[model samples]
Target: MSETHTSPVVLDVWCELQCPDCHQALEDIRALRARYGDRLEIRLRHFPLEKHKHSYAAAQAAEEAAEQGKGWGYAEAVLARTADLASHGEKVLLEVARELGLDAEEIDTALIDGRHTLTVDADHAEGKAIGVTGTPTYVIGDERLDGGQGQEGLRERVEEIADRLLAQG
Candidate 1:
């Protein structure tokens, strides 16, 4: 098969922080990134599920956190405590900000005021354009992986795609 595109042969993961499987998949990808370094550029996007009532809200909150240069940190906390959103409520999000060394009050204000709605909306639109229909869909170049596969499976696939990209170059 011919692997061709204007962009690099990168892996794009569209995930929801509320999904445990997505969290696991992201952990695996983080390890892979550490090992492979610049060979793979793993891009993360938001694909909050509709069933998770607080997911959109959380995504927006994370986006606001990003304004303070803590998006990934907030996302990590969200993924880590997927089960706590309901019981912990806004406290869970606040804890994430605190852990990331952010001003908790500022994050809370941003979340309450719905400051990052547009950023999250942009992520939603981008996810739709890329055919992201689930919490943890992956796009390997032009190929889409519907579910989170094992590390070996993902690595092998990435190697194949990287080989093709290298050949094209």
Candidate 2:
């Protein structure tokens, strides 16, 4: 595991919100982030697959949540509500907003009026620049993992990279 000491390692995850693998990978990423804390910077970019019908809207909704100062919370809500979204996209998001105590009127306006397009587009472009071709893809420092892996695989990989970064210091 190679590491560059001059900069913090960036773990950029490129994934669509609707993907099951992406959802699971996020759980692992969250655990790793908690363990490593500020040793790594975790970035999440959207890579909505063509097959998933509601991913784009869902990504936009999360971006709207970011606008409301609840990006992370809204993200977790969306991930947790994936089944609900799969069945009822907008309805699920509204329910999530209510559950999280966000201003439903504002979220409804944002989502229905398409207010978060720029942010979502920027995320998409960034993912493209990093050569992310699939859901649950991760770029740890300069290295990339382009598909889902088991929890142990993810943990070991992240830890190995973290250790290398620390060593470089």
Candidate 3:
């Protein structure tokens, strides 16, 4: 009998770049990536809250980073300094781009031109439609886990769902 291969489970993580809570949730994201590797498809969906002044721009910068093939790297760098981001705003975004060897000018242009606004807006809208009201929200299958409530047991719950999906596959 021939064996069939099913697509990996998609895990959409709703996040706000300027949010400290979302920064903290990076640990769990890394752990999940390490645990599942290719078995789980983890997607970072932007949900820039109005409270964070620079979050919307940061989301657009993240899209520019993706265009440069340094999406996760740029995000991790920016998320590592949420305080700086809050204080310095767009400057911090450009700094991270330069630090990562990405085209800072291009990122700046992308930001000013609002080229990635539609993408960011779309993600935000989808997040809202799915009831994602906070950063670090995890959506696996039909489950929506809000890490804003608490990070405790979130990773375990994600693992359970991922394992079940992989098993079914």
Clashing pairs in 1: none
Residue-level lDDT of model 3, residues 1-169, one tens digit each, is 9889889899999998998998899899999999999889999899999999999999999999999999988998999999999998999999999999999999999999999999999999999998999988999999999998889999999999999999988
Q: Which pairs in model 3 have colliding backbones? A: none
In model 2, what is the error at residue 85, expressed in angstroms? 0.7
> Runs in model 1 with CA error above 4 Å?
1-9, 148-152
Per-residue CA lDDT of model 1 for 24-137, tens digit only, reads 776667765776677677776777788877787788777777778887667877888989985666688888888788888887788778877777778789889877777677
TM-score of each candidate?
0.80, 0.85, 0.98
Worst 10 residues of 3 by lDDT: 19-28
- lDDT per residue for candidate 2 within 88-108, as digits (tens), equals 877787778888888777878
TM-score (C-alpha) between model 3 and the true structure: 0.98
Highest-lDDT candidate: 3
lDDT of 1 at 51: 80
Candidate order (TM-score): 3, 2, 1
Clashes per model (N, Cα, C within 3 A)? 0, 0, 0
For model 1, state the Cα shift of residue 18 in Å: 0.8
Ten-residue region with minimum lDDT total, candidate 2: 146-155
Best candidate, TM-score: 3
